[model samples]
Target: MAAACGLTAAATMLPLVLGGGSGDGARPGGRPLAQAPPAKAPGAVPAKAETCTDPEASLQPSSADGPTIDRIKKAGHLVVGVDQNSFRWGYRDPATGRLDGFDIALVRAIAKNILGSESKVTYRAIPTNQRIEALQEGKVDIVVRTMTVNCERIKQAAFSTAYFQAGQQVLAPKGSPITGYNDTLKGRKVCTATGSTAYDALKAKSYGAVFADTATAQRTVPNQLDCLVKLQLGLVDAVVTDNALAAGQAAQDPAVDLKGDPFTTEYYGVATKLGNDDLVRRINQVLVDYRKGGNESPWMKAYRRWLAADLKGITGPPAPKYR
Candidate 1:
């Protein structure tokens, strides 16, 4: 699961160091955190000439090495952009100060497949809004964070076949009256990460809820974990994020929990820059092998290790689909 002891200490000490440690809405230095200008939410991609219907369908699995593969081999290590705060998916273990989780395991699998060494990787902690930017700028070879595949994103980046399935859900304190993504949110402040699908959902239909942090001096934070912080500090009444991630947040803090069932279906994919067909195909091939072995598959083992405890009922990784 998580680094129990270290996470416990972090839960106790993080708020104290970050700002407000209590639910009284007090911030450090007696000044509220500044709200950054809003980033475009990474919801469904806009319609265009190349609009897609099946974003999960990717290039056929291939072991072939091409330009992107050659470049990565020449570099001798994989540069992966990931989130260091999303527990169970990807996070730096406070106990050992090493990255560990489901996504980290997949990154290591990719590294071992491409570089013949799992340890030969450099992780760059990227925020939600910058996933595509990092890849397009050649800052990272691939992004394995819980990035959802959709029509719009495919236009900007190539993706491997679906690896994990997730959906947006609500997270709130245990005793809160905010039941779910319903009218109960009327007039209540909700928190979501900037550029996240959750923000998009709220923007499309708020149910009388207030999500624009600028109006409340609480703009959305870059990381999903930051939403958990705001929830702890009473800055927002509920948090809307991926249920897979909300499970981790609930595990990290017993005071909060997922408030409702998932509202939409989405798939997680490993994203590479556009035209990185070689790398994308190679990753698809890796996923093909990674999904084998049934119950003993590496994917299932990872799920059991990190996710089963909090997010249950997953039988296996999503079947890979090819274009």
Candidate 2:
């Protein structure tokens, strides 16, 4: 029965990526790459919040019991939504027919801690835009995508304390003239996932960059090697994605490199439906316990296994708080 379930899940994923489902929103055809306008440095003060209420403070976890933990316990499984396309964060191995990455490892650890077995996890591969919505609709219990825990996201879902710190960065082919975010690539096309924070940040910087939907961006030349393959083929001058993702790309292909230091550091956190305090608290406890023990925790071991190359020589304390 378990084998059948896994096969069904895998079948569901294949069409989604092969452009056969409603999920494939846009096709990948575009004009030749144009140079993007020079972008200003990223440290400009953010515009004042028009809405006075703090999103984070408003969504604070309560001590009251919530449905998420109860649902997991009753089902005897942990349903985690994650990005299956990201290399270091989450992706499937064709040879092993298994999904693995830093985020997957962490989710497995959470399942083991909560259900006493790692096998109790049911992985749901989710698109970037659907992560929070999936959680809110009860389609998944938790979202462990490389999702940023921002004030805006907190408005919709509760977030675990940060598990990884990342920032916005640019990926360019080797020897590209673009040195950093501030470099002028004016009139040059830059590719970024549609509806992503990287796009938002680049827009905010007034880079006048072009945008491509994520699916389209992934299909262009060299096939899923990295987000910046378009740049390597000169389809676009640059690609903007998370710094961690950029790092992984650089590690894999010496021909591609991350340009400039990352601007605007943000924390990656697990996301759950709004008002699920009991589950949030339980997860928080597990996170706190993991931190106290350093990299000895199961989560850390998993991190090392899947992300050792990206996280090489890096050591740090665990996150300060959970949900």
The TM-score, computed over Cα atoms with residue i paired to residue i, of candidate 2 is: 0.75
RMSD, one per candidate, in order:
10.5, 10.0
* Local accuracy of candidate 2 as per-residue lDDT tens digits, 64-169: 4456566676677777777665666777754576777788777877787778887887666666667776777676778888887676787788877666666677
Q: What is the lDDT of candidate 2?
A: 0.61
lDDT of 1 by residue, 1-323 (tens): 13433463453332212212233312122210011111223343231211457778999999989987887777677778888888899887777777789999999999999989998886777888878877777777899999988877888899999898777788999999987777888998888888787887788778898888785457487777778877877778899988889999899888888875666667789999899898999999999888888899898899899999997777888777787
**Residue-level error in angstroms, candidate 2, position 218:** 11
**Per-prediction TM-score:** 0.85, 0.75
RMSD of 2: 10.0
| Poorest 10 consecutive residues by lDDT, candidate 1 | 30-39
